[model samples]
Target chain A: MIDLSDLSKSFGGTPALTSTRLKIAPGELVCLLGPSGCGKSTLLRLISGLIPPDTGRILLDGQDMTQTPANRRPTAMVFQSHALWPHMTVARNVGFGLRVRGLPRSEIAAKTEAALEMVGLRGFDRRLPSELSGGQAQRVALARCLVVAPKVLLMDEPFSALDAHLRKSLREELKALQRRLGLTTIFVTHDQEEAMELADRIVVMKKGAIEQEDTPSGLYACPATLSVAQFIGQMNVTLATARDGCVAWGGRRIEMPVSGDLTLACRPEDLLPDPQGVPAEVIRITDLGPLLRVALMTPQGEALTWLTPRAAAPLPGARIRLWPRALHVFRGETLLETIQPQRLTLEEDA
Target chain B: MRRFPLGGLTLLTAMVLAMLGPVVTVVLWAFAVKWRYPQILPTEWGLKFWAEVLSRQTITGPVLTSLALASVATTAAALICWPAAFAFARLRFPGRQLLLFSFIAAQAVPKFALFLSIAVIFLQLGLVGTFPGVALVQGLSAMLVMIWIPTAAFRAIPPALEEAAFDLGASRLRVFLAVTLPQAMPALAASYVLAFVAVLFEVDSGLLIGAPKVTTMPLTLMTLSAQVVVQDAAVLCVMIWLPCFVLLLLTRRFMTSRGIAEGLGA
Candidate 1:
């Protein structure tokens, strides 16, 4: 287990990481998700001891490792740039950590071969870094870290340089490798879909602080704030007036418990066209093979989108009606209302 | 239709011939047995002049002396330049820009003016006629240019390579030796060659401080020029130019192989 408490760092008088705390269980794969310049990489550097924190205590396996340098720490990082040494061959690069630890040449060679085999680079031991392709270079970097048998593996956008198809394949490969080794890992990225697909738990960050941390499904289904909802996926926020167990917006009222002003969120796929639903006008329609994105303007001039199985073949400037479920409500950054799912009663009981 | 500009090619050929004319004339006169006033060509040709120059023991000693001094001076300059170049490329200490500017200024100043004072200092230290004294003088003058050009080359290397080495648990020294130095070898070789050639022909300090006791080919050529006719002086001049010519040939070969000429659009 690794724990960071009150971690903070600054570069040239600018705060890179503010006071932050996080905990990772043994063998857990947690991802730090944020946009660019959101301080996710800074946190990883601090944990790996690449840069010392201004104020913090890092505990690994119940031992204080705050003052330990990077070489002494049982942590390794695969940088976003893949920082492979161009001068060394693949085998030497993988065995660098062992050589630094004063291991025998035979032991270093054996461990290096094993690590290379683990990363599916068994025959590439004699090749220089420049000889490898982008994906192969990343695999060499991963092998370099794995050879050390570090307790915690830190990756900072390791797949960002790869093409989309390769990225998907490598992520699965990395996940499988992590599970087999049972290594506790911290993966950092600005990509939301990657975070959702790979992380057991995702930590959403904004600026220098974490906004929310939860299972990927939980964060997606129940976002904590407007920022979290918009960052994680497509969100259409509508302002509404709340009064006496009902919310009213754009000339439509929905039955839900409300206490004050509120914001409503609905996934694009949830909204649909119904002849007897609230009146709306179709603004634009885009077809995307498996789905269609339909944009509509309400009578009060509020714009929204809904996804359907087929393109709505309505003519331009046609009016339509959409019935969407009641929005999850939040008041002043606090969860204020959740509408229970409506149930249809049987006529036999009646 | 546009006519081909034979005029430009004619002008370029003329420029090349103009540069080669004087050296070609000198080599021809050096080999002639005799030439008199108003004669465009020699009256006779023989190896007598070459034999005279080659057989002189005094001339041979100065050639050896000059070779030794230049070799030692160039090697010393390389030793002093490497670390300074590395630091100038990598580190940001206080007064870095000022120090770098000082080295540039040292290269700008003419060596003759500095040699006068350096001679007095050498005499005071009782090193007036020694090989080490001449070498030290040449090294001091050549150090700035040797170090600065190579420092720029080293700076051009990607810093990512060094960072990668460090992340792999290598110390700073190991990173420098394993990565940075190998990448900068081509530049370092160029700098050493340039410094060696510069020191080989240096005469100002050597003549000013160690003329009577310590001798070099350049000082000997100067003496021979003053005593003999211009035709006789040509032989000594050709002899002195031979080694530098060979060195220039070697540099040209290196420059071609390294694509430095192509890079410069030469």
Candidate 2:
């Protein structure tokens, strides 16, 4: 287990990470997800001890490792660029940490070979880093870090440099390795899809502070803030007026427990076609094979997107009504409530 | 079967003649015993002058002194500037750009003029006509290569490599030794060789600071060319050029590395 408490850092008086605390269970892989300049990388660097935090305590298991140097702490970081020593052969690179620890030569060699086998590069020990392909080089980097048997493994967008196909394969392989090793790992990436696929829980960072931290489905289902809702997935929000447990938009009213200036937010897929719903005209339709992304403009000039099954998608220029299956009620950037409405019966639609 | 490229052939010939013409003339002069005016080649050729120049104490002493001066100056320049180069490459401090510019600007000034001013300072400090004074002056000429090439080489190494070493449980010093230094070695070696050759051929500092008591190879060669026999002077020139040519040949690969081209801003 690794625990970070009250971590904060600034570069040249501009805060890169504000006060933040996080805890990761042993064997859990938590991804720090955010766009560039959102402090995700800074947070990762702070945890790895590459840079000191202005105020924080980093605890590994129960030990206070805040003052320990990066090398003294039981943590290893795999960089986005692989950071392989170009001069060293794969075997030598993998055995470097053990050599630093003054282990017996035979033991170092044995552990290096085992690491190579684990990363599935068994016969590639003698090749220099320049001789390897991109994926192979990253595998060697992984093996180099794994050989040390670090208590915590930190990866900073390790697969971001590779092509998409290789990135997916490597992500799966890394996830499998993380599970097998049961090491507390923190991976940083800006790609939400990658974070969703790899992380046990994703920590979404924004503007030097964590915006939200939750399981993938939970975050998608119940976003605590409006920005979190907008960032996680494609969401459509339209202005509405609320009064006495009712929200009204586009001359249609939904009975919900809310009052004051409101915003109705829902994912594109949640907007269902229904006769007794808010009316809009389809501006465009994009075919994505199984689903159609329908662009609509409400009467009040509010634009929205609806993801519907291809067979049920209306043509462009067609007037249609959309019933939000689940609506997130936001009052001034705060999610007030998530209201789920039941499907209308056939008789009611008629 | 294929027609030769007339333009390329002419350019190649011109380059070969332009570059090799002086060396070939020097070699002939070193070997010739007698050659009359208007004669295309020497009437007699032998190693007589080579033996005479080799046997002379004046020639051999200056040759040994030049070698020592070049070696010491180049080594000392490297020792002083490598850490400075590393700092310039890695650290962000006030006046860093100004300091780096000063190093580059040091080489741009006419060397003799610069050495003349430095000689005056050396005279005030009682360092004139001393080996240390000559070495110090020669070492100044070496500073550009010793600093620039190693600085560029150190900069070219991604910081991630060092950080990776640190993350893998190596201390700061160990990371530098095992990771950073080895990566920069090729450029460092190239710079050392280049500086050594430059110092070896350097004349102004040897003339300005080591005069009266200390005479180097370039200084001796300059003196010989002025009044000594042409054959003896040519022999000394060939002796000076040989080591430089061989050293460059040995370090050619390193010279081709990015550090040299980038450091020189080529």
C-alpha displacement of A306 in model 1, angstroms? Answer: 2.5
- State fnat for each of the candidate structures: 0.22, 0.76
Query: lDDT, candidate 2, residue B212?
Result: 80
DockQ of each: 0.23, 0.50
Write candidate 2's Cα lDDT for A168-203 as tens digits: 999999999999888889999988889989999999
Clashes of each: 0, 0
DockQ, model 2, C-alpha based: 0.50
Extract clashing residue pairs from model 2.
none
Query: Which stretches of model 2 miss by more than 4 angstroms?
Result: A243-245, A279-283, A287-290, A313-319, A341-350, B1-13, B32-46, B227-229, B254-266
Cα error, residue A307 of model 1, in Å, equals: 2.9
Docking class of 1: incorrect
RMSD of 2: 4.4
TM-score of 2: 0.91
Give one digit per residue, the lDDT tens place, for model 2 in B77-100: 999999999999999999999999
